[model samples]
Target: MIDFWLAAGLLLLVALSFLLIPVLRGRRAQLEEDRTALNVALYQERVAELQTQQQEGVLDAVQMDAGRAEAARELLADTEGVAAPRVSRLGKPLPLLAAILVPVLGLGLYLHFGASDKVELTREFAQAPQSMEEMTRRLERAVAAQPDSAEGLYFLGRTYMAQDRPADAAKIFERTVNLAGRQPELLGQWAQAQYFADGKKWSDKIQSLTDEALKADPKEVTSLGLLGIAAFEAERYQDAIDYWNRLLVQLPPDDNSRSALQGGITRATEKLQASGGKVAQAPAAKVAALLKVHVDLAAELKDKVKPGDSVFIFARATSGPPAPLAAKRLTVADLPVTVELGDADAMMPQLKLSNFPEVQLVARISRAGQPTAGEWVGRSQPLASSTTVPQRLIIDSPDK
Candidate 1:
């Protein structure tokens, strides 16, 4: 802090000195021009008097001419060495003294009283150290001070949300909306808060709010996504499908939501497929989707286990449990080193993991290199393979 203030003081002094220079220069120039003008006027008046004497026959032409020449010479000599009005570029050394003294004084004061050692002092000061309740009180005060400040209202609402006071949050957000006017993102965020505050029951009001947001911004991804989820929850599967489909087109190809979209599509499609709904059959080659998972065991576990070693190799589905999702286990001494599954497999087909599909199988290897389970070992995450062919898995949390 001392160093900063010293530097700032020096910079300010330098700037003031720079500004002073222009003023001094202008004054000096004006003085020099005035001196020059006076000299010229004096010479002209003397020459005029000399000429008048010669014309009045008071003096000879030679005398008048000599007088005029002498006046001219004197005028030239007076003006020749006339200094360019120096305003003592060094202004009495008082400013220089002040410049040095002020910084030193400022540094001393800062070191003694005002210096903060932490780099985050400014940030800490801006965002005070306080509980959520205290912050809310401060926010309320700030809002009262400046009722129309969008920033104040925004932070106040966010603070309410952070405190899990969704009703308060909704109220603040609604007030902000009224004051600041409609913003699709803000509207969606506020609507969510309102929905949670009012309970999860689906209401036309929530739908209307979401629809209004979507109308303002058709590709408002969060609102559209939430709307899809709400529709699915309401058993409006077709509506969910349509909303998700529209959202899918707007989403990037590799977005996480693609997985959810594929899940919704599959659920909808499965119902349609079972209901004998007409699916326009495309050409055999053109109508293709791929879903696949590849497993590579850790190098430490490879080719080290003996026949007696308990080894478990199976595929567990990724959706929910109680769906017979796991594949039949095989030992390390099994006939084929690599097991590949495809569409022909009834339980777990070899399908492209794309189409944002969930993992249909989990290949587990026990920690003891045995099927019985010393400690269940294998990748817990659903491996992303391909999305061209979609499939579903019924996976519960690992605790199951």
Candidate 2:
């Protein structure tokens, strides 16, 4: 920040020089004019002295004339090379006043309209913060600098939540939603913050927010976690277990949060059993639909493709969204491989194999490694998602 201000000050000085230099030059011109005027007066006085000496008979006409000529020559020498005085419609005071006002007005307007606060905020964020409080202060300033910045507001809300200031977090999250639209992640955050801000009390507003988020994306991690927490707090252990288990599947196998989530599930199970209630299992776990596929390249086209070309096998709903419900990627070198696609292999939680009644199976060979568009493609007729039969796919036809 110091460096930035120093650079700004240097630039301001450069600009000021442009305004001040002209006024300084004008002063020098005035000084030259004054000296020229003094020389002219001295020349006139010397001429008058010569004329008086001739009238008193102290000198002859030739001597007098020679003296006058010498005086004229001296005057010419003194005034030589001096420029004619220029008339300025705007005299000394106006230029001097403008020189002073140029910098002052420039600075004033810049302070009123420039992004100095944003510049300072950027500098502050470049350094590692000393503490959470310092970091919060920086975020606050950032949000203030750009009130419409949804990303900044989102992070600031999270920071407030970490600081246990739920009310502040709720307000920030609400503003973020308003600016960025009701995205599932933001809606979840707003609901959780609002829930905590209301002293852990449940309200229709919070419920509505959570419902809308989950409906849009069942795999919304924040909404799932918040729902689990809310249910656990309300002593609905079975509900908590169900929500947490669904969330657990969405996490990667090696995620650090897996152990914590599993522990939560275990706790919820124990609580449910203690209350003489059976723990409900997730429905998807009971009858998960699995489709087995054997993929191979047609003999006629085998020589046309390289061994390293990519192969994509997927299932999509016949009459639903175009996005694949389950998909897998392999290479042409792995042809004649048997693979399985199931609910566990769903591309998105909301678009699982079990959610669709019927789907079409497809296998594509792509030299460019693209999944949707490929070099050669094959597809199976629509079949029940729960079919246990193994289907065969041959990549024989050129993709349209």
Candidate 3:
């Protein structure tokens, strides 16, 4: 029975080899035959035309003779002196050997290594499901195997996010940033993770990250939206307006997302109006009881020659838009500089900084050095030597 099976296998192998080798040769032969037939037809037509011209006397004898010679040269070159190129019997041996040997060698190797061991594809597939937990473990294994893969780190971070583990997600995103510096996707992911980790504080750090992301891709809607939220939180009403405005420009007019964004704007505008509608009238230049430091004017007191060149002043209700409330650039820098509330600076119209309460006062020589700008000299509360006194501004009640 073994001998009969071996003989039958050999017959099957030989039959397969015969069928495979002939198909290649047959296709090649067909192409060569077609080429030969086409060339023959073209040459015959040229020769017939030449003969017809000579008989009809359309061409003189010399021209007719020349055409016949040219036609003969082309015909012989194309046909290449008789039987068209045929498949070499010699070429048959290599394919015949490859067809017989390759499958046999492959089958032998597979039988020795692959077939002997049963592959549990179901178990393997089950081992790596789309669950974030399993995916994270799989990513850890893959990254451990190949530490330099950027893709592994990126996907791993995404998996952590999917798992609702922002702390772990932040760590993975940090790795991605270290490996691939400042990629837009990495920046956005890192920002999202950071935002979550910060107790969902969309106040300061979120805006910083959002700015970085927008710089990376100006059209990033998510970043822009977050930026609007940050502005709203920080009481930057006009900034909130500008951010949402740019976003609206890119979003489709009919999109419901627009209405959602408009709701944010309406809230911010109402907050701004509630805080203190545009600083209606500039405060009096020489208010008798307030002290203020002019940041711009203080810098001008460089290389101090005299003692009376600079003055100290306090501002009350100073935190709002910087320029004219009506201007387009309604962005405000850090304000509510707490100098002594009732000081001599209340007199100068140009140094009119006020709008806060209980601001105590002090003064220094800035002693003989290039008199630093009064603004850069650092203002502090009365009786407090340092400027680190954190003011809990009632952002909700600006007039307070």
Local distance difference test, each candidate: 0.62, 0.90, 0.57
Which scores higher on lDDT, 2 or 3?
2
Q: Sort by TM-score, best first.
A: 2, 1, 3
- lDDT by residue (223-333, candidate 1, tens digit) is 777777777677666666777776777667777879978888778666756767644432243223233434444555555545443444343336322232334455545
Clash pairs, candidate 2, are none
- Report the C-alpha lDDT of model 2 over 218-247, residue by residue, as the tens digit: 677888999899899999998898889889
lDDT of prediction 2: 0.90
lDDT for each residue of candidate 3 in 1-400, tens digit (9 for 90 to 100): 3564476578767767675857686667777788888988998899899889888989988998899889889877887745556646756566667777776876687667662222332233356576666667767877765677788888988887777888888888888888887755577778788777776677465567666766545545666776677677778887787678767766777888999888887787788788886423322443343332322224333433243333322232223212211101000122223323332333332122232223333222322322222322333344321233333211111111
All candidates: TM-score: 0.34, 0.71, 0.33
* Best candidate (score: lDDT): 2
Give the root-mean-square deviation of each candidate in angstroms.
Answer: 19.8, 6.6, 23.3
Candidate 1 lDDT (Cα, 0 to 1): 0.62
- Indicate which candidate wins on TM-score: 2
lDDT of 2 at 251: 85
